[model samples]
Target chain A: MPTMQPLMLPPLVIETQNLTKAFGQQKALDGVNLQVVPGAIGLLGPNGAGKSTLIKCLLQLQPITSGSARLLGREVGSEGREIRKRVGYTPEQDCHIPGMVGCEYVTYCAQLCGLPFQAARQRAHEMLDFVGMGQERYRKIESYSTGMRQRLKLAQAMVHDPEIIFLDEPTNGLDPKGQAQILDLVNSLWKRYGITVVLSSHLLHDVDRICEQIIIIARGRVLVHDTLENLKARRRGAAEVVLSGRHQEFESACLRRNWACEPLPNGHIKVEHHSDSLNSLLGLLDEIKLPPLEIIPSPNALEETFVQALEISHATA
Target chain B: MPLHDTSYQHWEGVHLGLWRRRWVIARAGLRACLQGKWMRHLIVLCWVSALGMTTVLFLVGQLLVANSIVVKWMGNFNPALQAFAGMLTTWLEQHPEISVRTTQDVLFYYFCIGLMRAGIFALGMAIPLLITRDLASNAIIIYSSKAVSRGDYLLGKFITAFVLIFLTWLGPVCAAWFVGNLLAPDWRFFWHSRVAVAHVLVFGAASMTVLSLLALGVSAISSKEKSTAAVWFMWWIFGGVLAPIAVQTQPWLRHLSFNFDLDQLALAVFRPAHDLTIAQTNIPILGDMLRGVRPQTLASLATPELQGAVAALLVMLALAAFLIRNRVRPE
Candidate 1:
């Protein structure tokens, strides 16, 4: 391992302070502040949500209008080469070299990241194999299928064995099976190899399946930044209870107990469990003489959170 | 549980420095260029001229040695061969100036022709394959995403073109020079002509730099190889054909042709000493025919040919660099 200089001390794997990017009068990234620790982090946003722009800015592929970003403890703009040596990026676009085979393309990428020729070649094969590209590795990139191209892209990004890999839409165009396979591969990248992954995608399920931490961005700003567990935990203890009889009486009884309640048209009442225990709610239901049919706890799904965040962001604008 | 062991293995190998990364790009590009059949054929053709020149030198050396067998054989030739031999002797005698005084002069001539042929090949074939293909595919993003910068990528492509031109230009000249020395009577010819070797190096280096920059600049602006190749041929062919016509009507238009400008530069760089006069009579008929189309009367031009060539080459290099700098970006 290379020695880390003391002057470059930063514990976070990715940190940005008030990062802003603008083109003429329009700003693409506005006062974005992010501090990410090393793990499987997900960047989720709708189209034109600045996810790709943020990744580019952090990679130093594009200059930021203002503010600063550091990756793996090195500043982005000034030390882009040094930072890139330790970080890998798979761009969203189809950026394959013409007339190069899969192995050759990956080997060239590894060489570009400062690996010697022999080492790069060896690593390229290993990465190709790991990506499940078998005999097809010898085929020219232009001849590969869409799935193979995505796999090849992943292989090239990981060929150097960098500390972290930024995957932008790794499953952009794929069937369900291919998507599942790629997601599985991404999950293993972190779980088995100890490599940190930052998966940027609009697919909530993909991020939910792979990333432990999530950052949702909307309209060039980060709407929410928290762990998936925490976000879901905040929405816990809320339940929708169905009634068999006396729905109005049950709603009145819940209101008297200071529980927030709203009766639905389907004879189900939504209630926030503010009391100490569910037993109390059971006792209150019994006292109301309303037969409880069913009760289901409603934890906030990542999809709902993403949508709500976008709505709030739009409303603010 | 995971479906498969898509594990990431740690790379325990040593990491190399960025100093030689540009060579990696150049090597890959060179390999890609050599893979094409047309480029390979052109490369082979580049050496054909050198071989022809070397054969001529060998025959001249034999004639100078007064070998009895060659003379006897010439005396017994058919009418056509006898007529050619008699004409050659008459031409040689009429122009006492038409003599290879030293092997250096022959090597310099071969090197100039070799460089020109190689420049054309590189501009037409190698530059398009190496640069335009990458741009057409938007592969610059992949290259720049790694530790390599945009400048490094451009420099790498430049080196690719430079190496191809070197092989096409200098490689043949060196081979011809070796043969010329070996065919000479003794080491005296080699010793006297040694300075020409440095001249070849300087001339080859300057020409390759200018041509590589110009080709790469044109490649940078255009995305498709075919479009770039068309633009390149149009510039060279039209400039060569039209500039002469324009210069005939307006003598001041001589500097308009890049080919003429490069030729002027070559003349200035390879200008022989005043005592070593050229043997024009000994040159083949084809050489004499081609000279009529080439720009003549370097001294009569409004500006010094050498200065105009240098200024034009520098301007081309600057334009190429500017276009490349603007085009090679991730955005």
Candidate 2:
């Protein structure tokens, strides 16, 4: 093993101080401040919410407009080369060198990460194996299917066995099974391989299942940044019941029972759980004889938290 | 559990220096270029050209020596000897003023120019495969995402295309020089020809650097491979073949052609060492003979001035560098 340089492997994965990026009059990253640690972090945002821009800024792939940023304790632009040595980035687009076979392309990427030729080739093969790619590795990347290309991108990103990897929409255009397989590999990157991952996407289901930390950005500003557990724990006693358009009776019953309820847009009623247990809502459901079709309890849901964060950001704007 | 207790992976290998990574880019580029059928065929053609070119130099070196073995061999009455002699005589046919007193330095200049004519094709084929394909495929993201910098990427690509162009010309020139020197009469022959070899090196470096970068610049600006190839070929072919037609009228229009400018530079580089007398002028008499124009003296050719050649090439090189610098970044 090579001697580990402390500067190369800092404890904090990313630290940005009021980092801003602008194109002419419009700012893509509006004075964003963040300190990311090692974990499976989901960067969630709606379309055009600066998720990709933030990743690009953090990697120094684009010039910052103002302020400063660092990766693994090194300054963003000045030390970008060193920072990239310990980091991997799988871009949201299909990026493969033309006229190269899958294995050769991966080997080239490993070499670019500073491995010697033989070592790079061996590492590339090992990474491809780890990503569950097989004989298809010998084929040209131009001929690869979407799933195969995604796997190739993943393999190339992990070729050097980076400490952290930024996956930008890694599951885009993949079938459900392929998406599941990729997510499984991504989960393993953090679990079995112990590599930090920053998964940037708008898909809440994917994030909810794989990410421990969530950073939600909307309109170029961070709406929320906290642990998924903490965000979910912040939820109050609440239950959203599918009342099947019979909100008036449920509203009357909830009013008599001293429980506040809001009728949702999708024909559901969100009831504030004042009772110590869910049996209160259950007992009320039995008394009203309006028997709900489905009841969803909060205080452990990411969807509610995600929606609330987006709503607050929208309201602020 | 955020992956059941987050920890750094165990493989904490040392990152090599930045130069090594740049070399990696260059090495990969060279491998990719060589994969093309045109590149492979061009390499084989260069080899064949080198063999043919050096064989002439070998005979010339033998001629420069006293008591030459080939001259002695030609005296044989064997049927094979007569046929070989006939071929040599036909090839060695030259003007009365040029045949007996040709110097090695002037010959080296012609040799360099000859190989360059072939090299234009090599450049046309190899350069499009470099930056154009990368841009077309959107692989700039792949490179930018790595530890390699934008400068490193361009330099790596420059080296790859430069080597391809060099192999097609300078590499063969060096081979011809070495083979010729090895057949020389003695150490004095090597000393006598040192100036010519130096001229070839200087000429080779200048031309290859300018042409390779110019082709790369064309590649950088355009994303489509076929259009890039077309643009490069048109620039060289039109400039080389058609520009000479206008040279008869304007004469100075030779500056518009990179090949003409480089050839003029080649003449200047060899001028100091040429052994031609004031009564004679350097002329590839057969070139004019084939063109159906009666052979004329160098004084009548009206070539582009050396200073103009130098300035034009410098401007061209700057433009190429600027294009590559701007377009090498991720879009």
Per-prediction TM-score = 0.83, 0.84
Which parts of model 1 are misplaced by more than 4 Å?
A1-10, A239-298, B1-6, B62-103, B250-256, B272-304
Error of 2 at B111 (Å): 1.1
For each predicted model, how many residue pairs clash, with residues at least 3 apart or on different chains?
0, 0
TM-score for chain A, candidates 1 onward in order: 0.81, 0.82
How much lDDT does candidate 1 score?
0.78
**What local lDDT score does residue A92 receive in model 2, on the 0 to 100 scale?**
94
lDDT string, candidate 1, B1-331, tens digits: 2354445668877777666898988898889888888777776876887787677666665444333244447757744554565565555445433444433554475457556766676667776776788877878878878998887888888888888887677777777777866775445445555656666777777777888888888888778778888887888887778766976597446565667777776666666422122423245463465345324442332134687677777777788889888877776
- After superposing candidate 2, which stretches have Cα over 4 Å from the reference? A1-10, A239-271, A274-301, B1-10, B76-102, B248-253, B272-274, B278-296, B300-304
DockQ of 2: 0.40
Instruction: Count backbone overlaps in model 1.
Output: 0
- Alpha-carbon interface RMSD for all candidates, in angstroms: 2.3, 4.3
- In the range A52-146, model 1's lDDT, one tens digit per residue, is 99999998888999999888988899998888888888889888999988998999899999899898998898888887888899998999998
